[model samples]
Target: MKNIFIINGHQKYPFSEGKLNSSLIEKAEKFFNNKGFSVKKTTMEDNYDINEEIEKFKWADVVFFQTPLNWMGVSWSFKKYIDEVFSMGMMGEMSDGDGRSKEAPKKNYGLGGKLNGKYMMSVTANAPKEAFNNPNETFFNGISEDDLLKPMHLNFKWFGFETMPTFMAYDVMKNPEIESDFKRFEEHLTTNFK
Candidate 1:
């Protein structure tokens, strides 16, 4: 990717100070820069202009999202951001807006993505990775961790961006192996981009 856009989706709250996400963002910025990719980033804490955020998407070849799972889903701020930004009609104009004519409301429901070939990758930090592996687990019954991000993948696909395999850091709050996780994440960036 020649130009990459990174969104740090962690919300600053009383429970978390957003340190891990910030560190990951810093590492990613430096790593990509060293490899000569033009990188741009924004944190949820920033004062963003709607137009500029859209412009960034237009300029990027790939987008990387960093987030923490709040209540098993993305934070409220990130969801709000998506709602506001994507509603501006970045997902192309179908013949009938959502590719559905009034006569056939169910025909082409979700095929209006504008950026056809651009890609996205998500890196999430959350509870223990093993929590979702057991058959008796409430979160996921032996499903891969990537499944937790299915909604996000579909959302990005709606905008026409191809999805990349996600990177994750588990047990972040309880007992994060920061050093090991960073190594693995660095390796992921290297292998995926190369």
Candidate 2:
């Protein structure tokens, strides 16, 4: 946890411009800097080199993803970024071909990751908190936030990164409690990082 890489995966739209995500990133950066940790960041809207991103992952002890949930998943642009960067990283940078060998090919699937860092995801969603973890909820049907974000988690797990508890700002669109969310976010960082 001495070094951190923060990725802002918010995609801009006419209705959402990623201001909240940016603020969260800023807060995390400040928190890490105050704790004497080295911090690096990438905003998906900006042009980036894939090699540099791999290097950042290699250098970091922890990678923090800040994203806005769109239609139950990360934005399309961020998904594209992940597809590109992680694909390139497969060449011995982040992983070394799916962790299986010719001798025991079927035994150790997805065990070939080269990095040993941890990853955490903080996401914003338009859906209300009550909609999740309730078996009576029609859509989610008792699914937790982490369950909904399993794909993203699996991506990191494929590269051998450990999971950190996820954070979410629920009801962000219809009935936002921006100030309370920010406070809770700071508390999250403190509780987890300390």
Candidate 3:
């Protein structure tokens, strides 16, 4: 909780310029800074070194992801970043070769993480809140946001990181509630971190 690493996983498109995600990242940065925590950040649109990112993961006590849910998953650029960085990290930097050995190949599948930090994801989505956690909902059919984001959670789990509850600003495109979302975001940070 003392040192935090934030990843902004926003990829800009013609229709979506990533303003909301950027704003959320800014708010998180300010919150952590004011609380006297050391903060490091990365944006997918910017150039980064794989080794440096691994070092940041080692240094951080918590890793926060600020992303927009695009087509039910993270943006393509962020996915590429994950592939590159995590792939390089597999060389004992972040993990130790899938946490398995010749003695027991199937015993420990994903326990090769070198870092033991925590992770949280803050997401923006075009879908409404009601679309989730309601059995009547046609699309999700009672599936929660966390359920939708299980893959991303597993990614962090592979690195031995614990998961914090996720935050989501739903219906951002069709029903923008910028102010309310900002308020809730701040409250979430306070409730979780403070």
For residue 66, give model 3's deviation from the true position in Å.
Answer: 0.2
- Model 1 lDDT per residue over 122-190, tens place: 555556777776777766777767677788887777767887768888888878899998999899888
lDDT of 2 by residue, 37-92 (tens): 99999988999999999999999999999999998899998999999999999878
Off by over 4 Å in 2: none
User: For each candidate, what is the lDDT?
Assistant: 0.77, 0.93, 0.94
Lowest lDDT 10-residue stretch of candidate 3: 106-115
lDDT of 3 by residue, 1-194 (tens): 89999999999999999999999999999999999999999999999998999899989899999999988999999999999999888889999979999999988888898889999999999999999999999888899999999989988988999999899999999999999999999999999997
Candidate 2 or 3, higher lDDT? 3
Off by over 4 Å in 3: none
Clashing pairs in 1: none
